[model samples]
Target: MSVQVKDLKVYYRTLRGDVRALDGASFTIADGEIMGLAGESGCGKSTLGRSLIAIDGRMRYVGGSVSLDGAALPLDDQAAMARHRFTAVSLVPQYAMSAMNPTRKIGKLVTDLLRSRGIAPDTVLGEFRRRLELVGLSTDVLARYPIELSGGMKQRVVMVISTLLDPSLLVADEITSALDVSTQKAVAEAVVEFRDRGFVASTIVITHDLSILVQMADSIMIMYAGKPVERASTDAVVSSSRHPYTRLLLSSLPEVGVRYEEHRLSGIAGRPPSLLNPPPGCRFRDRCPLAFAKCAEEPPFVEVAPGHSAACWKA
Candidate 1:
């Protein structure tokens, strides 16, 4: 396995109480797999991605184990994780446009980041420029300030910088959310190119957009209320999702050939349950149309078919 997360639990500490962001997530990404994590907003998708790479303040590590390339990650220790941050694990966080330092030139910023990893800037300058070109960015971008670049340019720059050391696992959190439709396709393709080129051994693309996942992801995993509800190949999930939540989510999407004027588009009703002091059973019970008495108890996330898994009693 390229990445393995076993019963990982991460929560956020607030004055109200701990928000059970990641109750107990267990999954594995095979070598070179590009996995897409999709869900409604605040479904702990980003939390799961960030937990594997870094645990920020306000985020408490309740319990869990994250392993990359057979070595265990010190997810609870912030400072100790520095040894793995860029070289072994890296992140392209949400809002890539705003992630750059507005005060410094892009080149200087990259140099500073490389130096932080104990690397001399001159040593990787050649490869750095090449990567920028590979992403359709000009070498002149290195000389400009972040404010001077467009949003897509900034995103590409961040993508290059984040994976400069060729990390073993890449956590891309909503990397394509802020781009325009055209730029979105370009950026999304860039991600696939990154994977195909072996910039990272495997990648986890976290987004709420299922269409994007269908285009690029090898497999898709759906998350709800801080837990993984269903996982299967992209085609399998899109065509025949077994879990009620997954089926409802897929139904809500607008089909390509459908015209809204003639055929109506449906949406999933009801808001997601709050993670703070969430109900004991399935978090999606209240909203799941197929929910029954069996749903009163938590369903184990188990495999129901070859390479397919779901956490609903019906599945």
Candidate 2:
């Protein structure tokens, strides 16, 4: 496996109390796999992605283990993780447009980042420019400030820089969230192309859009209220989802040629439970139509079929 997470729990330290953002998430991504993580807002998809690369001040690593390429990730210690970031595990964070420093020219920023990592900037300059060209950007981009570039350009630049070291695992959080439909397609394709070309060993793409996953992800995992509800191949999850939450989520998507006036689109009802003091057992039970007495007890994320798993008694 390229990435392994076992019973991972991450909490946010709020004035009210610790927000249980990630509650015992366990999964594995094999070598060369592009796994998509889809969930609604506050479902902990981004928290999971951030945990794999680096944990910030407000986020506390309550428990769990994250392993990349057979080595444990020092997520709780930023200084120790510095040795692994950009080389062993990398992140193309959600806000890539503003990720770069506006004051510094792109080339200088790249050099400083490489230098901070104890890598000689001169050693990788050639490859860097080559990748810029590959992503449809000119070498002159290095001389321009972040303000000089377009949103898509900055996003692609960040992608190149993040994978410059050919990290074994890459966590991409909402890379396409800010782009237009056309730009979104292009950027999404670029991500998969990067994987196909082996710029990274495996990738975990965190986003709420399932349409994007259909194009880029090999497998899809659905999360609800800080827990994984279902996981399966892209085709299986989209076409034959087993979990009630997954079914409701997919049903909410508006199909082409289906006007809401004629065939009304349905949305899942009820709000996601609060993570600060979440209810016992399944967090999604209140919103799940098929929820039964069995749902009062947490369902195990066991495989119901080959390569497919769901945490639902019905499944």
Candidate 3:
């Protein structure tokens, strides 16, 4: 395993109470694997990604451990984690256009970034130009300001920068959400290209788009509220899901050729439960059609098929 997380619990302090953002998430990502994290809004997907790199002021590391390449990550200590920030783990944040500095030229920004890490920009300048070309950007883009590039261009630039030192693990949080359909496809393909070219050993693509996940991810992990509801290979999760939540989610998606007029599609009726003071037992009980009296007790995330695990009473 390249990445192993055991019982990871991260919470956010609020005036109301501690919001259990990530409660006991455990999983592993193998070398060269692209794991897709799917969940509804505020389901702790972003919290899990951010916790691995940097913990914000609101987030409190309540428990658990994260290991990369057989070494434990000092996620709680900002100073100690500085050594592993960009080189060991990198992130392509949600907003790429706003990620860059408008005042500095792209080359100067890269130079400053390398210098901050005690790396010589001159040594990597040739490689940087090659990478820019690899992403279909001109080498002359190095002289341009962030404001000069379009949204897609800026996103690709951020991708290049994030993987400059070839981080072992890359977290791409909704990187394709803001782009048009064609641009989204291109950017998504570029992400896979990064892995193929050895720019990053493994990646975690966090998004709610199951269709996109089907195109890019090797494995899919579904989260409800603050806990994992299902985990399996992409094929198994899409075609043989045992969890009601996963089944409903997949069914709700409209395919490319599926027209609403031809066949009416229905969305899940009830909304996801609030994480704050969540109800006892399954968080999805209120919305699950197959929920029963046994749902009063929390269901363990157990393997129903080889490499397919779901946390549901019926499963």
Candidate 4:
């Protein structure tokens, strides 16, 4: 496994209390695998991704371990994690389209970032330019300010820089959330190419857009209230998902040729449980149609079929 997270728990420090955003998340991503973490808003998909690299002051590591290629990550220590940030693990965080410095030209910004990492830009300048062309960006973009570029252009630049060091793992959180359909496809394809070309050893793509994952991910892990409810190969999850939440989520998506005029589109019924004070047992029990008295107890995430696992009694 390129990445292994065991009982990982990360919480948000708020004025009230610690919000259990990432509670007991455990999964593995194999080398070269593009694993998609999908869920509704506030389900901890982004938290899990951010925890693998860096957790800011507001976030706290409650417990658990994250290992990359068998080496444990210092997720609880921000300063200690610095060495692992770009070379060992990297992130293209949410809202990456506007992540660049407004005052610095693209080239200067890259130089400053490399210097901060103790890497001289002259050493990787040639490869950086080549990567720009690989992602359909022009070398002339280096001279332009961030504001001078379009949203898609800015996103491509960020993707290139994040993977410049060929990190062991790349945590991409909602990287395509803001792009147009065509641009989204382009950026998604670029990510797959990064893995195919060996720029990153493994990738964890965190997004609520299942369609995008369907396009690129090798496997899909469905999360609810910070815990993964199901995980399986892309085809299995889309066609033969075992968890109730996974089934509901797929049913909610609009079908390609189905008309809402005849068969109205479906939607999941209830709001997700609050992470601040979530109830015991299955976090999805309140919204699951197939939930029973057995749901009052926590279900273990166990394998049902070969290579497919789910955390529901029905499964």
Model 4 misplaced stretches (Cα beyond 4 Å): none
Candidate RMSDs in Å, in order, are 1.0, 0.8, 1.0, 0.9
In model 4, which residue pairs have backbone atoms overlapping below 3 Å? none
lDDT of 2 at 116: 85
Model 1 Cα shift for residue 1 (angstroms): 0.6
How many clashes in each candidate? 0, 0, 0, 0
lDDT of 1 at 165: 89
- The lDDT per prediction is 0.92, 0.93, 0.92, 0.93
- Give candidate 4's whole-model lDDT: 0.93
Candidate 2, clashing residue pairs? none
Stretch of 10 with least lDDT, candidate 2: 257-266
lDDT of 3 by residue, 207-250 (tens): 98988889889999999898989999999998899999999998
Least accurate 10 contiguous residues by lDDT in model 3: 269-278
Model 2's C-alpha root-mean-square deviation from the true structure amounts to 0.8
